[model samples]
Target chain A: MISPELQAHLQSVIPSSSRAALRTSVLPALLTGVARVASTLRAAQHVSLAGTANAFGDDQLNVDVAAEKDIRAALAACGTVVTASSEEDPVEKPVVHQDGITKGESQETYTLAFDPLDGSSIIAPNWSVGAIFGVWDGESALHQDPKTRQVVSILGVFGPRTTAIVAVRTDDAPPACFEVGFGDQGKQTWELMRAHVQLSRPPFKARYFAPANLRSAGEDARYMALVTHYISERYNLRYSGGLVPDVAHALTKGHGVYVNPVTAGSRAKLRKLYELFPVALVVECAGGRAVDPATGEDLLARPLEEWDERAGLVCGTAEEVDLVKEKLLG
Target chain B: MISPELQAHLQSVIPSSSRAALRTSVLPALLTGVARVASTLRAAQHVSLAGTANAFGDDQLNVDVAAEKDIRAALAACGTVVTASSEEDPVEKPVVHQDGITKGESQETYTLAFDPLDGSSIIAPNWSVGAIFGVWDGESALHQDPKTRQVVSILGVFGPRTTAIVAVRTDDAPPACFEVGFGDQGKQTWELMRAHVQLSRPPFKARYFAPANLRSAGEDARYMALVTHYISERYNLRYSGGLVPDVAHALTKGHGVYVNPVTAGSRAKLRKLYELFPVALVVECAGGRAVDPATGEDLLARPLEEWDERAGLVCGTAEEVDLVKEKLLG
Candidate 1:
């Protein structure tokens, strides 16, 4: 059910060896699975509870559980995913073989880590939420540099419209990003919204900022100064309390910087493999930068080892990211 | 075309004298028109512009212009809307009569003021944006107490779902809020999602904060203290750079406070007619409080005589708003 354009796209950016598997099962399963998450959220929002809290984060709202189940099921059915992890489960699990038709362990085989639902804390308010996926070319997500092994990153945004920003990498060409949308009456079809998406490009002076962990400002004076600097210089504020939407805003504007600085008082909470890696890959592929705020090194340079590995991030348009590192990290 | 439940709702909240008009024209036109805004935004997000700033603001994106035309046209066709205004075109203008049948200049003849597309600055990133409308029962939105004259307030949220938080105030009963979704294969019909929506109620300590104009903290010490207090107390952050979504989040969470303070250094930018008043009515109806950040008076108590009346607002759960006032204003 994929369009020819998307078909051609997967062929070019994904390694030639993995193209058939991607076309046959991987991408279809991924997109369709995320679409189901959208429907589940829409349906969940409808069930009203008067005098009840409007939020879903504290106890893993049913929507979170449903998103994991739906996306996990979609991937497991592909039979190409040999191993997978989720923000919810975290433990690497062998996706149960359902169809009994499994692919041999090869470079074409994939490993995945996903935050089935990100920013659930804000969902009760019906603010936008998202799902993050990082896909590796081989069976395990460990002991490998994501810059070379991680082939795909997809961020599915749950907002007024259901959309996903897909980033792909190939040794042959510069990594690129694409925007796809879920629509059509049945809410099942995935249509290409834009191809070759990129962050705000050259001659770019910083324009927008998504500053997370503002609470850290109270703990760290430099953090507070950084916040003031942005205002004094007049950078547009776009913090949405969600990693995917915040970075996605930069990917959408092709300009902007996102900084989640780690202070001794406010340790960084974004998990590397599930949360940060996928988003970092996507932003980098879109002609932006993603780095550890502490060292300002490439975020992808780090291997996925610890299941709960967390890091502070400064990512987005390369120039703005540089400014963030100089002002805060330096 | 209206559902029995909605029809019944209108019959009760709207005066008996205006019931037939609301049922026949007002609500239908308003809902359908906002649905069009959702569609326009979705469509606009698709027309990708690479290498361009990922934003539709500054000079007014095409989406903003298109939204005003669509909603204004829909309202004008009802022939019952005598005067209308928009954040885009702030001057009050007569919605030219489109239909031959016009309602008499009675209480049923409505007045509307809308921010056709609120938070357009953030829309470029595919983040959620919204429409805010205040509907009065008579010809002018001026010289009237929005607490009473503003009979209906609709907050249209454009996100993974196209939904609205509608608040109605009637002399006969307590004000109440409702949530509705736009769906079905056609994206034309409105279905009840939840009824009698309210903010988090009794024994509630605030859980969320939408801090707008945080840049003001640089200018005012109290503003900085307020941000620190919220952080120290660990108020969940729910800001999305949009007034409607920020306030809607509070309404949905059933508990939260949103504060946009005006310091000697930073003047208020939210207009009374298009943004503040409508949201105030809805929050109040939902058992929340919306007050001027400085004076701590009922926002609706002020008359809407000025077209561009800007006010600093502290709204949401009553107790949290009080905390904000005490910490900063006092």
Candidate 2:
């Protein structure tokens, strides 16, 4: 009747032995962390700034710091996370618990990398912003290439209505997507929005998003030309200056493309591990494609060799991503 | 202490005799209609459309037809409206009430014009869409020149959080804006987010929205050139293909511009009565400016002489509007 809940779906995909482990331990902690962060962001009008710049040279709004702390505290309470890192932190740190700090001792130990509050810049203007997280089971090497310890789970939380897009993969299966929202009873409930939602790119309208401030002088002129061409072809422009919602729109609508490409005019903006890996995995699992411009290969083909290196990403239906390769990157 | 409620603000600006009339009659009915429509639209996922086409030749989703019915039904119960019209309906029609079908006889009778679901096309994709309404007290003639019966009250309802923006004016005073949302006990309550908010143009980072798909061979080349110039100036594009939320973002952010212009390539797209008049009035009241291209004057300088005439609008800080006039329209 309710279809399989996200937790139930996670259980169904895993070996029976580890099903309870995920259902009772790791997923609950991750969900709790997201909910707490969502509650904090709901009252964003009152959030203050810490007056410090984040690792990315973006000012760390006070809300970002608070959300990170809240997520960390929530995860620590669940006692399943061995390590955690965020865009605000310089390096991965052990999750300290009441019993003791986790040193990656247990086989069930999990690691989390997150952007506690993505798109913080647009919060004051009542724009939709989100929190994104990626989780790995068993801490192999906290900062290794994403391929080395590929994330088993990914989460995107859009603040309004506390809506969540959660996807989980097990063993060697494609990721299964589920949605969570507050029910009429004011309780958090999950529903399966898509089992394997795929993209169909034919008859593409050229809807896309590029960062507003592209370098005035650079190889980006080709990218600009592609945008102009798309406009001339009558593609509707639907960018919101937010990654989570923009990507979600593409998925929900089942078409269109989103790119963060490297050019002479602008360095690739999305980072491989913190941002693109989880997003790319979700898009690919949903029957879409995610490509890296540098190698002209699938973005998920390998673990990111450089943690801080800029990564170009093109994602959508196979046709759309292919067109980006041919028209924009070729 | 809480700032004055929208109703109280409305009372302060009007004569004592008419203040109660507006407070007890017209405003409540308008607010109720908006709330009913907003509640209906919040779950746009479930709305069943009649599968008809609206007057604009755009396909009408079932939600549009349903919202129009809901709003009309709510208004019919209030017994204060003399005439009403909606975008889904082909023409302005008299409101037949429970007491009896009375023409525009009493001075207290008001006329309502609304777009029951603006930007309904984007609803399926989870984009923010809104309901807009404008009220004119004492309907001299329905669907006449927009200049003849200027709207005294305008409402924009963003369905996500049941947020309503109400602007009211009386006795030739500048309009006051207030925000309404559901409070404890699920009762609608009002808060003043901006008391006489004004736009200050400086250090402009271009954040703007102009609908894509401009007629390819139309006289709009100069407008396109101005957009290119803005991009060169590093203005950020933030269009959601929805007008109410797009314009609301510009107001709430206190910066940015929103334009719906007519060029040789295309006629004015927004309707003078249902869309532009209310939006232009709100933008102007909020310390911003709204201009009509054909007349090269303030949008509200006079009533639109034709109900069905296409109208071009440019709204933002005075400086930005002036720049638009000088650069594109010049």
Candidate 3:
């Protein structure tokens, strides 16, 4: 049950030139589709350890494969999406026009990069798992600058509630980030929960820290130093092994830093195109900073890696990211 | 929709002597009551900040107060609970018998202590929160060691799924801990998801860390050393700021250690009667260890604190808990 209220919100946030097509056709199709996926993921209790390995060495859980297949099938059903690529299957695949006979007025096509299950390593815990999707205009997401072309970021959280931290970015207006919930369990209805979302930084009580890849501290002195700094600073610790929840925690708390540094010895484990891009889009839209840990360059501004490239990221409150960059990279 | 399957399970695990009464009357009513409460909590999107402060001087949220009230009302309505205590309002309150005309045959009266909302500090983030309850057969919890007196522990988790880690500790037979789910959202049904839950420790690949109260590390060198040890040992990190989820994660994931130490400079913040006792019951029932971080005493062996006495706890996989105790308490 997609809400008319959210449809109205899409109208206000999207540029007026494409309002008619996007509001009525494109975004609604995607929102409803993702909501359904979130619902399906929520109802599941996934624990099977015997599943085929993906292109990566990580063994794909049954739920991971199912999520990817579900997202692909969902995107295909929408017909508005031009292309999609997922973490389990990173190759870009095209979406067909399923609503051929019922097609409406012309609208910009969307190329989506998604991690159907962002935190499979942490999934078995029956803790909170999530789905991350990045929406861009045109046929491909290969070299596009995420900041300009990335139209939306849908972060589906499978926590107590099937909630999402969604962002709508338009060239004319500022990017909008809101928290929305899928209606009652087993129901398809969607409701707009928080109208606006922002990150809490210094001088605010919402301060916390999510230190990912702590193993890297053994190899990188700077990573160790930064962690020591956070401890000494008394940053409340909140590092769930899952990526979506870690970043989303900072956003919902309106404070904190999700810092995963990739030093030479550490090497990167999180794929840039699927995991980082979508998360960074959502973070930046929430008035936070999503930057490369080493150079502090805006991650969305950097050209995405071609095939399953992994890297480090610093995202959350703008000030905290800056502090991480200064201390971690130095 | 309470499944006949779980009710059947209740009968099998509960001691045969009290089986009929507990299965037919007391436990069912309590389980149903908690299921409804979990459902109500899952549906809510709590962010209200204005509320009264609890005895601990921490600002309580409206949701916190409401949860306490709801649990009290539910317990009163159940009519089998003779006495109860709560974290928000730590006083022991007597529950009035409501089923006078419909009262069943002889059954044991139960006493309960609960932290209705355990992770309110992390609630603003829209992250996972939980409910912890400890049940005793006798009238009072004062001076009694939780291990023998604590008959059951209901660890209600408000995650994507309305779930619980329920432990029924019986002296006559082996204690049983199982994971159960509340039926679909908006439905009052219940389902048993997992029959057995055990923790993963040294020999398992599911090792993880949930470092609560890292603020104490600045004042305590032992804690800082423990953190460094975890990083170097490459334990996967998973410390959400919520206790219910953190402890529940260990039970669900079959691994992980949630260590919070109270030092000379860093005072304890978790209440022993409600928070630690309830959580310890669940952890121990899952074959894990729950202990005082300082003396390494079995936490369940300690007597209940009359008021909301705060202390440190180290809980989870047996090997991990022992490792934490040696490293952090040394």
Best by lDDT: 1
The ten-residue window of minimal lDDT in model 2 chain A covers A210-219
Lowest summed-lDDT stretch of 10 residues in model 2 chain B? B210-219
Q: How does model 1 fare in lDDT?
A: 0.78
lDDT of 1 by residue, B176-277 (tens): 788877773343456776777788765655477878887767678887788778776666666788988888877776888889988897788888998898
Q: Candidate 3 chain B TM?
A: 0.93
Give me the iRMSD of candidate 3, please. Answer: 2.0
If both were scored by DockQ, which would come out higher, candidate 2 or candidate 3?
A: 3
Name model 3 segments beyond 4 Å from true: A2-5, A97-107, A186-189, B2-4, B55-57, B99-105, B186-189
Top model by TM-score, which number? 3
Chain B TM, every candidate:
0.91, 0.85, 0.93
> In candidate 3, what are the lDDT values of residues A100-153, reduced to their tens digit?
523222566778888887777656555677888888788788878777888888
True contacts kept of each: 0.46, 0.16, 0.54
For candidate 1, what is the DockQ-based docking class? acceptable
Q: After superposition, how far is residue A79 of candidate 2 from its true place, in Å?
A: 4.1
Error of 1 at A294 (Å): 5.1
| Residue A324 CA displacement from its true place in model 3, Å | 1.7
Model 3 TM-score (2 dp): 0.93
Interface RMSD of each: 2.6, 4.2, 2.0
Candidate 3 local lDDT, B201-234, one digit each (tens): 5687646788888888888888989988888887
| TM-score, structure 2 vs. true | 0.83
